[model samples]
Target: EDQVTQSPEALRLQEGESSSLNCSYTVSGLRGLFWYRQDPGKGPEFLFTLYSAGEEKEKERLKATLTKKESFLHITAPKPEDSATYLCAVQERKTSYDKVIFGPGTSLSVIP
Candidate 1:
């Protein structure tokens, strides 16, 4: 079975502050890792997809990077609008199909 863990369960940051969120995983075979952001009462919004180690993607103030054992989502000069729960999902390679495993998620609060 594939498993993922997100660190700091929750984070509090002042507006314009920057930080990095962690997502670590363990699986038999990894297909890819996905990043998402969810606001209260809304479904997770797709952020980035990483296929292999050393891969990176960015959107506005958010940047996601992947490694062999874990992935990181870095927030640069974030604003209150960026405050949301960040999630990391991993797709495990299966014989017939792919199984996705999602991390618990890290809730972020940015105060102005």
Candidate 2:
């Protein structure tokens, strides 16, 4: 079975503060790792797709990196508008569809 765990279930930061969220996972026949940001009552918005170890992607104040067994979402100089729940998911090499497993998520609150 594939599984994902995120640390610091919730985080509070002052404006301009920076932090990192961790996503640890274990999966067989790894295919890809995904990062997303979700707002209250909204679906997750895709942020990145990491296909292999050492892969990384960035957008605005967010950066996502992947390794063999984990991934990180680094937030730099975050603002109140950046506050949201960040999600991490993984897709394994499987024949069936909907093989992606999502982590509970890290809820971030940036106070202005």
Candidate 3:
């Protein structure tokens, strides 16, 4: 079975603080690693897609990197508006594109 687990169910950070969250995955064959940011009561917004090891992608305040066994999401100088649930999902070779699974997520709060 393919599985993804995220650590630190919740994180509280003062404004402008930086931190990194971990996403550990176990899959038969990893087809894609996806990162999403979801706000309360809203659907997730796609952030990055990492395919191979040593690959990294970045956005405004977030960076995502992938390795053989896990992925990391680094937040740099987060702001109040950056507070949200960060989700990591993986599509295995056995799973179809329409049947992607998601991790519970790491809820982050940036206190102003």
Candidate 4:
């Protein structure tokens, strides 16, 4: 069975601190990887989409990178407004269609 796992169930960082969140997966055939951010009482917001290994995407203070079996979300100099739950999802090719697998998510709190 294909599975996605995220580490550090929760993280607290001071404003302007930098850190990286991890997402690891096991799948038969990978199609794509996705990153999302969800604030309290809100739906997940798309952050990045990675198609192949060594691919990287960046937006604002966040950067997403992918490898053969893992993905990383690096946040540089985060702010209080950046507090949210980061989600990692993977799309794997199955027999007839693509299956999207989501990790439990890492809740991040940035304090001022």
Q: Give TM per candidate.
A: 0.97, 0.95, 0.94, 0.98
Q: Better model by lDDT, 3 or 4?
A: 4
Query: lDDT of each model, Cα atoms only?
Result: 0.96, 0.93, 0.92, 0.97
How does candidate 4 score on lDDT? 0.97
The segments of candidate 4 whose C-alpha lies over 4 angstroms from its true place after superposition are none
> Ten residues in a row with the worst lDDT in model 4?
1-10
- The stretch of ten residues in a row with the least summed lDDT in candidate 2 is 91-100
Which candidate tops TM-score? Answer: 4
Please give the TM-score that candidate 4 achieves against the real structure: 0.98
Per-residue alpha-carbon lDDT of model 1 for 27-68, expressed as tens digits?
989899999999999999999999999999998999999999
Pairs that clash in candidate 2:
none
Q: 1 or 3, which is superior by TM-score?
A: 1
> For residues 24-43, what per-residue lDDT tens digits would candidate 4 score against the true structure?
99999999999999999999
Task: List the candidate 1 regions with Cα displacement exceeding 4 Å.
Answer: none
Residue-level lDDT of model 2, residues 1-112, one tens digit each, is 6799998899999999999999999988778999999999999999899999998899999999999999999999999999999999998877776488999999999999
For residues 43-108, what per-residue lDDT tens digits would candidate 3 score against the true structure?
999999999899999998899999999999999999999999999998787544544778999999
Count clashing residue pairs in model 3: 0
Question: What TM-score, to 2 decimals, does candidate 3 have?
Answer: 0.94
lDDT of 1 at 109: 98
Residue 101, model 1: lDDT of 94
